[model samples]
Target: QQQVRQSPQSLTVWEGGTTVLTCSYEDSTFNYFPWYQQFPGEGPALLISILSVSDKKEDGRFTTFFNKREKKLSLHIIDSQPGDSATYFCAASAGSNNRIFFGDGTQLVVKP
Candidate 1:
């Protein structure tokens, strides 16, 4: 069974602070992991960043960590801003099936 789980259902970060969220998957076959950000008012899902198995990626104020053996993934936001407040989802996918398993999502609130 493929499943993805995110920790800290909700998070509060001050402006200029750092935001951290963790995710774990039960399926080792999952090789592609992507973190998405969603805002209110029926906004479209925004792709924050992506990570590959056994690799770490960072771009601007965002960073991602992936552990293939541990089946874990994480996202960190440097200098959190009020505009960054939104629901973030961690998703994973494997080969062929094209099935994506997404975490419930982590609700983030950045206070100015």
Candidate 2:
């Protein structure tokens, strides 16, 4: 996808609650989608993402949902903790170049 857009500039979730972040892409040619997390004063890191062949992929308390028909994807975090507060970026990549296009990022705040 050439352009990825994420919703809700920022959000706040309570500890042990669930947090959701959404993203939409313009192009369907893109194959790989990834979600990244970044904390203040630190570089973005891979939180939980895969090659994403299936509609849903999950790891621990994190889950990603992809809707091929809607051209949208979302990240769901269950049992959210204060430490989980950070900025998340949704991205897509395609072709042999492996160039990834990222969304503007959503700031998540997990309250204690």
Candidate 3:
């Protein structure tokens, strides 16, 4: 069974727009949530992350909002650019046992 789930499966946006990706988890012990961005032929890279104690986390153009009580989270990509076209993944960890769970990625397309 999948512990984490992401919606939309895919997304498209024009340059300068913003895209929102949502995720939910089934595990109550999950305390760490990380969002990853991956380009074709490349491995996923950490984009942003949040702890259960934190409600939000942000990087340059990436932001993650977490709701531990609800076991949900969302990733926001601002200023979407052509180069931003890639797959985004939502992941969660319990901070123990070296176990991590990943959601099916959402493919994003940015048109010029």
Candidate 4:
């Protein structure tokens, strides 16, 4: 039941536009939420995160909004730029095992 699902396999946005990626989980035990951003042919790095106890997290142009009651979460990118084009992954962990479950991923492209 440790499955996390993400929507919009790919997204294309113009520079300065806003991009949104959606994710949902099947396991209620998931308590730690993190979003990873990956560039071409590179590993993902942590962007923003929120615990089940919190509802929102923000870092610069990246923001993660979480909903514990709905078991859903989303990442918002503001002032999109070509440099922001990359694959975004939503991940979750139960906080007990420390093992993380990741979504298939959403490929985002910000066109200049």
Candidate 5:
């Protein structure tokens, strides 16, 4: 039960709009939470992360709201821009094997 899943294989939003992506996990043992952002031909990079101890995390235009009790989380992009157009992945790990379970990914396009 170490799988994480995301919804909406793709999304499009106008510039300066807000976009929300959802994620859920099958394992309740998960503790470490991280979100990765990827651009064309580029490797995923850690965007923002939160531990199970915390409920919310924010960085610049990115925010992650996590619900440890429900084993679910979501990412909210505020004032989305063309630059934010990319594949966003939600990931999680149980602090072992150094491996992170990733979502299928949500491709977001911010039109200018």
Candidate 6:
């Protein structure tokens, strides 16, 4: 069975502090990993992604560290601002199928 799992159901941090979210998958066939960020009223938007071929991926203030051998990955938020307070989901999918398995997000709160 294919599955994605995320840790820390919720997180609280002060503005400018960093937070880390973790995820793991059960399927070795999965190749694409994408992390999505979502605000209160809006839909989740793609934040960063990493391919199984690479071990790490970074975009601006967000970074995704992947361990293909262990089927685990982590998303790090650096210099987190209040605007960064949102739910983050770790999703995975195989290239053959359009289906993506999304883990329950970790809700983040950045206090000013």
C-alpha-based local distance difference test score of model 4: 0.93
Backbone clashes under 3 angstroms, per model? 0, 0, 0, 0, 0, 0
Q: Give the Cα lDDT of each candidate.
A: 0.85, 0.89, 0.92, 0.93, 0.92, 0.93
RMSD of each: 1.7, 1.6, 0.8, 1.1, 1.2, 1.1
lDDT comparing candidate 2 with the true structure = 0.89
The 10-residue segment with the lowest total lDDT in model 1: 44-53
Error of 6 at 87 (Å): 0.6
lDDT of 4 by residue, 4-101 (tens): 99999999999999999999998999999999999998989998889999898889998899998899999999999999999999999998996999
What C-alpha lDDT, on a 0 to 100 scale, does residue 105 get in candidate 2?
A: 94
The runs of at least 3 residues in candidate 1 whose Cα sits more than 4 Å from the true structure, single-residue gaps closed, are 49-54
Model 4 Cα displacement at 42 (Å)? Answer: 1.3
Which clashing pairs does model 2 show?
none
- TM-scores for every candidate against the unseen true structure: 0.90, 0.93, 0.96, 0.96, 0.95, 0.95
Residue pairs clashing, model 3:
none
lDDT of 5 by residue, 1-112 (tens): 4399997899999999999999999887789889999999999999999999999998999999999778899999999999999999999999967789999999999999
Q: Give the per-residue lDDT digits (tens) of candidate 3, residues 52-80.
A: 98998888888899987788899888999
**Alpha-carbon shift of residue 77 in model 3 (angstroms):** 0.9
Which structure is stronger by TM-score: 1 or 5?
5
Candidate 6 TM-score versus the reference: 0.95
Worst 10 residues of 5 by lDDT: 1-10
lDDT of 6 by residue, 5-109 (tens): 999899999988989999999888999999999999999999999999999988888899999888999998899899998999999999898888999999999
Question: Across residues 61-108, which tens digit of lDDT does each residue of candidate 1 receive?
Answer: 998988777888899999999998999999988856967788999999
User: Which residue runs does candidate 5 get wrong by more than 4 Å?
Assistant: none
